[model samples]
Every structure is written in structure tokens, then in C-alpha cells.
Target: MAPPVEPDALPSPFAGLPGALWLYRFDAAGRAHVLDATQCGIDAVHAPDHWHWLHLDLSDARSAQVAAKLPLPDDARATLLSPDSHVNLQLDEDEAVHGAFVDWAHQRGVDLAVEGQLRGDDGIGWLHFALTPDLLVTARRQALRSVEAARRAVGAGTRADSPVRMLELIAGRFADTVERSGDGLSVRLDRIEDRVLADSIGEERRDLAQLRHQTVRLHRPLTAMRRVLKQFEQRHPAYPEHELLPAVARLNQRFDDLDGDVATLQERARLLQDEVAAKLAERTNRHLYVLSMVTALLLPPSLVAGLFGMNLPGLPFAHSTHGLAFALLLGVASSVVVYLALRRMGVSRST
Candidate 1:
């Protein structure tokens, strides 16, 4: 076995790698094992037909060790020690390594993306890697609260029968993340709905905009995870023929459930958006109605005022002692007539 590095070791040759993850490989007995690499002692640990499961912290050498555990193509072996920016790019350094990892993932039917930000907002996506008779690799980009809790459980040696159980644990964390997010989303949606109803246009607009952006941001990684689980369910890799299938199948089911929850959330957000828009439109219509009434009430009085204010000697009502009263009466009558006309025309009160 290669010597273990201390946690505080000042950056391995693999340091500063974006999306860095630590990978731990375990044998069928749940004991640690190493992957294959052409580098000196690395090739010796992974002989022909050995199977292992790997646990990875996305920001450490955990992935490097797992890569070494694979029965890599020559190119993959070559890229193992040669540091690069992305883990996926390892295959670019050698077609064989690319083919081996790609084919292996394809055979196992894992829609795994080793690098790239999982949209940055849904936290990081995670998967536990397992090859029944060959290998297992679990990976994530950053420490998620749920993932950390699961990791503690694993480290405490709580019941992880095989890699499949660990997968369930990881999936459990993902489920919790979704649940927590759902709770938060529900609160926000409730508040927004209240605002929308309160007829506060500015506040309602901001809330709706925020809700839409948040929903879209949160939806991306979960959608990707559903695809990953679907991929996992369809592929069959060499593993212990005894019981791994059922475990993986169950995990796939959980993934489906998670997908359903995400879809439900998306639908709710859409409904909220439509409601907000309709309410805003209603408010706008009310304002427009009020303005129209005010303009109508002012039009006749304005004309009368203009005509009487003219300095012509014979202006109508200029010389009458009741001029002000008559003008007042005319204005009142004009307003009454206009109001009746509007009522007859089906105009509703707005303010």
C-alpha cells in the first residue's frame, strides 16, 4: 500500500485542481484498496480482476487514488500522474484512458460528469461509484451539509453493507438537500403570494422575479441528477452477482421520487408567476379606470372656468350676482351627468 498523506500535507502535486475531490477505494470486504496506475507501486495494487468501491471528497486527492484504481487504458495511466485542470480532461491526454473511463461509465450506465460546476447554486451533485467485481468511485465538488453528515456516518462505520448502501446514504443527503430547499421555497412562495394579493406592484414584481430566478437556479442540478439516476438504472457493470442489483434498483427509485418532487416545485413556481401577473394586470386596470374618471370629471369644469375667466364684456353669467353659485351648480350638475353616463356605460369605481 502507498503511504498515507497527512490531512495537512501542504498541497500534493494534485493541489489547486478545480473541482478537486478526495477518492477512497474499498474492496468487497469494505476495506480500502488502490486503483491502477503505471506509476511505480500504483500498478501493483490493482491487479487483473479486483473490484473496489470509492468514496471521494470533491476537493481532494480522493479522486486521484480512485483513478489509479481503475483498469485504465494506457492513456489514462499516463495522465494519472500528469496534473491537469479537469478530471475529464485526463482522457484527452490519452485516448485509451478516455475510452476506458468512458466505456466503463457507459457500461455501468452512469451519466457521470467528472468536472464542471453543477450550476453553482444547487450545491454540488454527488454519486457513489461502485463496480461489482471491479471498482466503485463516489464524487462531489464541495462539502455539502448533508454530504458531510453522511460522510460522518460512513466514517463511524455505521452499516454500509456495500457500495450500494453508501450510494443510498449519498442519495439520502441529496434528498434532504432537496427537502430543505423545498421548505425554503415554500416560505418564499407564500410571502410572494401575499404580496401579489396585497396589490403592491413594486414588491410583487420583485418577489416574482426573484422566485423565477431561484426556481430556475435550483432546478438545474436536480434535473441533472435525475438523468444520472436514470443512466445508472439502465447500465449493468460487473459486480457481485448476488445482491447489488436490488440495491441499485432501489436507489434508482429514490432518484425517480426526487425527480417528481422537483417537477412539482417547478409547477408551483409557474402557477405563482401566472397569479402574480394576473394580479398586477388587475391593479393596472384599476389605476387606469381611476385616472379616466378624474379626467372625465375635470373636462367640463375646466371648459366652463376657461370660458368665464375670459375678460370679454358680455361673457355669459359674468354680471350675475349668482354667477359663482350658478357656476358651482353647473359644475355639480355636469359632474352628476358625467357620473351617470359612466355608470350607464358600465364603468366601475376604481379607487
Candidate 2:
């Protein structure tokens, strides 16, 4: 398990404002400046070309109260405050883009990911945001690694000309996270494939099944996200001098490539699972065939012994001491004949 995010992990720009984590303002020239939370007031005034970005911590009790103050459409506000964890995006009637994006959680005290391994749920986080022409608002209940990456990019002097562009930057970081995870999953599948091909799979069927499920987990959401983006493109056809068109295309391309990789992994894992099942079935059939042969060879001896030990009035065997030897000899002879017959019938089989 990972430790929860510390309150001080994100520098609080609005000291007196509950739920406000960090705020930024960009001038017409696209220079980003850290701002106080007071600037987010509904009645606050700013220059015509000035835009603001306000990030809130939804874990705080007053986050909904703070979100209510933003001058945004009702749906956009609802999206920002939505608790749904699935990957989603919507271009509303008012043209406000809002969605929840999947991301890697930022762990403070421990590192759950060891080299090429992913620890599943320990690494998943969702970043929710709303974007319009000017203002961009992002909120999260847990700390997201994309937030740190975005902060670093801004600190390194990457200029976001618009709120949509900033959203792109954060989303690109998330895509990178997905790509990295896909690579890890690929590595794991490679090892699993090797094991499946080189060993008896009767024992490994469980692990192979789990790998297929994990691959599907990644594949499903990516497919859904791709569908969402395609819907966006259908609604707003691209033309010349459009920032969003190109941005959406680029984002979609990244996700599409990721989805392709995950899909391939999914197919490969499934094939390996099938191969494992085939091998296991073959083994089971071989064991059953051996058992049947043993049973056939023992059947004649069992019948001979049953007759010799019968409590009937046939006095021929009860009168002579040599009768015991004769009965044992008969049992051995019958067993030998049955063995010879079985050998002639052969153990050859079609796989």
C-alpha cells in the first residue's frame, strides 16, 4: 500500500481559501504567474487577455463550495465535481471541454512499482478538469503524478497559449504514463509467453489468466477513450487555423497507438492461455490413458483371485494342497496374457 498524499505536498497558494491548492494566471503574452486564490472570486476582475488556472483539492471539505464560485456552465461545474472514476470527456453545448482522465497516482513514502512491474490499483489515479476559452480548473481527490509533471514543465518555461493547451500538456503527460505502463505490461507478457512455450502449463494457467485480465483492463478503457475522441472529432470537423482540431488529433493518435499496443498484448496473452490449456489437456489425457492400461492389466488377475477365494462347494480346490499353487499359477498366467494382449493393442494415440 502507498501512503496518502500529504497536505503540504502541493504548495497552497490560497492560504485562507479552503480547498484551493494552487492557482496561476497567464498574461496576454502567455507568461504564467502564480496567483492567490482570491483571484478566483466570481466578481474578480482581470485584463481582457488574462486567463487563470485554479487547481482544487477535492479531499478538502469546502472544495464543492469553492467550485460553485467559478463562472462556468452548470454541466462543466458538474463534470469538475463528478466522482466518476472512468475515463471520460465531453464537449458540451456551450463548447466547454470537461472530462476525467486516468493517471498514475503520486505516492509519497513508498514506491510500489518495482522496475518493470506494475502494482495494479496502487498506481491508478484520476484527474478531473474543466476547460473553457480562458479559465482552466483541475481538481483531484488524490495526488496525481501528472500534476507534478505539469508543474515541472511550467517551471521549465513551457508556455501554454490557452487553457486547452494546458489541458493538452497535462493529458500528454498521462499518455506518457500509459505508454510506460504498456511497455511494462509487454515485458511481463513476453516472459509469460516464454514460460508457456518452455514448460508444463498445468501450474501456470492461473497466472496466465491473470495476465490476460490485466491486459484487458488496459485495453477496455483505452478503447472507450478512443471512441470518445472520435465522437468529438465527428461533432467538430477540422478546418484551417484550429487549435483544438490538431490537439484532439494528436491526443487521439497517442491514445490510439497505446490502444493498439494493449490490444496486441491482449491477443498474445489469450493465445498463450489457449496454448497452456491445450498442453494441460494433453497431459491429463496421457495420465488417463496410463490409468486405463493399468486397470486393464489388473482386471484378469483380480477375476482369478476372486474365483479362487470363493466360498462355494466346489471341493476340487479344497481337497489338494497343490490347488493353492495351481490357483496362484493360474492368476499369474492370466495376468501375463492380458498384459501381452494390451501390448499388442498398443498405447499409440493421436494428440
Show where candidate 2 strays beyond 4 Å: 1-16, 25-51, 71-75, 83-96, 104-118, 123-126, 152-161, 238-240, 311-328, 343-351
Candidate 1, residue 180: Cα displacement in angstroms equals: 2.2
Give the poorly placed runs of model 1, Cα more than 4 Å off.
1-147, 191-202, 235-244, 348-351
RMSD of each: 9.9, 8.2
Tell me the tens digit of each residue's lDDT in model 2 across 198-268: 87454567776777777776676577678877777887763424566688889899999998888888888
Give Cα-based local distance difference scores for all models: 0.52, 0.76
Measured by lDDT, the strongest candidate is 2
- Leading candidate by TM-score: 2
- Provide the lDDT at 161 for model 2: 79
Candidate 2 positional error at 39, Å: 9.5
